[model samples]
Target: MGAVSAPPLFSRDFVDDPYPAYAWLREHAPVHKTRLPNGVEAYLVTRYDDVRSVLADPRLSKNAATSFPGWRPGRTGIPGEHRSGIAAHLLNLDPPDHTRLRRLVSKAFTPRRVADFEPRVIETADRLLDAFGPEPVDLIRAYAFPLPVIVICEMLGVPPEDQPIFHEWANGMADRSGPRGGVGRSVKRVRGYLKELIHKKRLTLPADPVNDDLLSALIRASDHGEHLTEDEAAAMAFILLFAGFETTVNLIGNGTLALLTHPEQLAKLQADAGLLDAAVEELLRFDGPVEFGTWRFTTEPITVGGAAIPAGEPVLAVLAAADRDPARFTDPDTLDLSRNEGGNLALGHGIHFCLGAPLARLEGRVAFERLFARFPDLALAVAPDELRWHSGLIMRGLHELPVRTSSPIRADYQAH
Candidate 1:
């Protein structure tokens, strides 16, 4: 019999529960070609092995200019990236340019730097959770969203007064389904702000020798031998902010929801504090924030999962589906916190693996540890089935996570 027509791909229902469709695709059409809502046609690579291979394939290029010959204005790539002059960052480039930019930024975003920032992450998490009452509250708004926003803001040296403004623009820029005009405006505004901020930092470079923020580091790098252009600097900072916070938001939100739904897993995590790290990994593998790998265009004809993809066509590895492939994982559907397996595409694989993985892990580990420690009796306010997920192909996150503490606390009660 012929292959079954790909189950209604990327619809609202699929957004809410894509696993079943993904399973079907994995079994039947591992390299299924489908048109996205924006009218861009591409091949969706399913299966763990295929997804992993596709992510690292040299023949598949990430450079939008060279690879995406069918690019649609405002519809393809980040909205307004070209017009805002922030399109030259790592994600949109390849080769020597990608290498140079990533190396320069990595010098500042070191493991020691992330470790030093742990106290701040814990402080931010605790502060956000402190405001919660026994009554139901949307975790996304009160906790998940703002925690990372504040962390990234502080790291980027955005002043306290400007944080709200930054958050507004981030929200606007992140809305994948919002009006194109709104996204463009947000991108332009952020670009303008970054340009001005960079200029101001240059003037103070001599007087402000103690400045230690990531933005300051970038400016100094450019002033030194790094040779980074202003546009490149702004673009790198822009991607770092968006990439740093956006995934962590979902990591906390989705991971929390996963534990809340799977009481056994939650109990296991509660029983052993050592499991926090492993639990985060499991949560990421089970339902990571990134649903699909970023777009890659074929530089030459390639066969993925036995399906031939011609040169110049765009391909997306279904990270969500690949992570759940039964063949690659033992009892893949089961959420085992102690279960250890390698090569989950949740954080991605190969050269383009997420640059912010270390920071994301730190935030997720701290967020969950602080949250559960504070609210041991936490329970979902809404039925699990009633929860709504944002309708986007790239990000997998809840619209809101209404949760409440079941126990009454005295005025003197303090979070540990």
Candidate 2:
């Protein structure tokens, strides 16, 4: 018999529901080589242990400039000038540079700092829910998108009115089509805005008390002359603005959809509010925001799960796949909130573990708790087959979760 061909990596089928394909990869080709959406050849690590190992391996380089010299700055045709300023943030660095950048930003996003924002997050959730009347609404548009944007903006001291602009820029960056230099234009606009904001902050010094937002903290670090440069500071702000809200938005959106589909779990969660933390973790495990870890290039030839990946090749740790690997999790396909098997790579692992994890967790806990409490009868507005997933290679999120807040739970929930 002939060998079976590998499934298409970036097909519409893969996007709509990736778990099945992920399962196939884990069982057959744990270390699979595939073509990226942009037609670049890359290796994918799918098994749980292999994915974790690849993520923490120091031999793998995050800075594509050093490893993949021929590679250009942006995937969506972003301009060179605009790309470097934003791409030089913590996620794109390795070793000493990554360490230095992370340490400076870590201070502003410590667990305690994120804890202090809980009340504000809850308040924001309340306001969002209050604004959402008892009717069918696109939760992605009405709640999931705005709550995190507001929280992150307020923490960064960004003017509330400028949020729509950020949203526009983010949307453009996320577009996979690379539509006529749209990504480059968005990058330029956001970079320009951050530069101007930093300049204004530098010109003014508040007496008695300092600004507590992250941007001010970053600015102070740059001014102190010991840590960050002006360009680095701008890059840090750009990363925070871009990565900060995008993940949480998908988390809330995806988590809510999970609960709505699994009415029994939702009921269990609503009945026992104490399960909020565990429930959030399960939601993250079941379907997290980030589909894959950021770019990592093989500094040297490495064997992962019996597959040899050559040096200088880009590697992606498929988080969604690893989390759902049957070898790792019992009945991996099922979404059981009560399951206590930990070590899900939803937020990633190692030195590059998500800096905003604490914030995302806090937001997720609050969002799920309040959302369920507010509308116990929430459900999907359209048939499950009718819903569409985002086409982006890195993000696994529904384009819009049209949900009926007031409708009674459907009888055929499990069929989805």
Candidate 3:
């Protein structure tokens, strides 16, 4: 029903619905040169197995700028020198550095660490829901955004009153990525904020050991000479704060939108709490938050879907397409809560796989479980079509989901 023959994979239309474009490329030109808005050559790799292979392949480094000379952010003449700093956040690091950096804080993200937050997550979620009032509420403002914003704020040891600042920084960072956006201001502000945080940590070493948080962990890592450079430490903290909130904000918002759109499955979920995890996974798969995975650059010429991928070109995998591939998933477009068949690129795969996956999942399950349970009568406060989606090649999420609850019964019940 679609173009089985290879077609131009770089059109704006393809960027919007890259699945069909990806399918075409997978069938025809797997590795083709295309120009970005900056006119640099990039390779778009679309096959599911191929994406996995490429991500795992050591030859394609994430730090493509150094490895490949011409790569540049769209129109941001922010010299390649500055690009590496922006890119060095864990996502861009490879090998010994990546391994070392990840090790420094991996313990903090463990099941034990995240699990300890369950009670707080539930409490915080319930409080946010309770504050919903009787009026139609924007879920993003009410809970979706605040919860993760709050979580990351807490994780980083940001002062109790300091969430709004971090939230603004996250928005600015996202905004800067926009075509005509100005991020210099945001970058400067966030860097200043993190520098202050580092200063605070240095001045006040923790008196108690177990009160350790992400900040303390990073501080400990840095003090041992295994210490990251000041810039590296600040960058990691910045990455944690933004990545933590932005991803979860989308997960909860996107998941809720999916449930609202598919009431039957949602109703099934409300009826049986046990399906919550799978339902979250299903939502993550059906209309997952991330549309594409991290960028990859080919170090050597390669062939995929039978087309030549020239060396030193960027290769992008349409993760959204991989999730919906009919070849791997039956009725790829349909949302079935009962089906246990599992496959998704939502958390990515291989070495660059999302380090915060467990925390995101735990937060998601908490958000949905408490959300539906609290607002049994929750229904869209505005027309479904009225909702707005944030524009991004990477994020998939609604700007707001206004839902209202009328049932007094929702409040009378307690899982606590």
Tell me the lDDT of candidate 2: 0.81
Model 1 Cα displacement at 299 (Å)?
Answer: 1.0
**Clashes per candidate, residues 3 or more apart or on different chains:** 0, 0, 1
- Candidate 3 clashes: the total is 1
Best by the lDDT measure:
1
lDDT of 2 at 14: 81
lDDT of 3: 0.73
Best-first order by lDDT: 1, 2, 3
**Backbone clashes in model 1:** 0
Q: What are the per-residue Cα lDDT tens digits for candidate 3 across 177-292?
A: 35453555566677678768877875676555665677767767742467666577777777676667778888998888888878998889999988988988988888787776
The lDDT per prediction is: 0.85, 0.81, 0.73
Candidate 3 residue spans exceeding 4 A from truth: 1-41, 73-86, 175-184, 206-210, 222-225
TM-score-superior candidate, 2 or 3: 2
Tens-digit lDDT track of model 1 for 1-416: 12567789878789889999999999988988888988988899989999999988888888867777797655567778888888888777777788888888887777887888998999888888878887899998899989888998888888889889999998787676578488788988988888788778778979999999878888777424666666777898888887778899999999999999999999999999999888889999999999999878999898888888899898989999999999999988888999889667898888888888999999999999989888888899999889989876677988889999976543454544
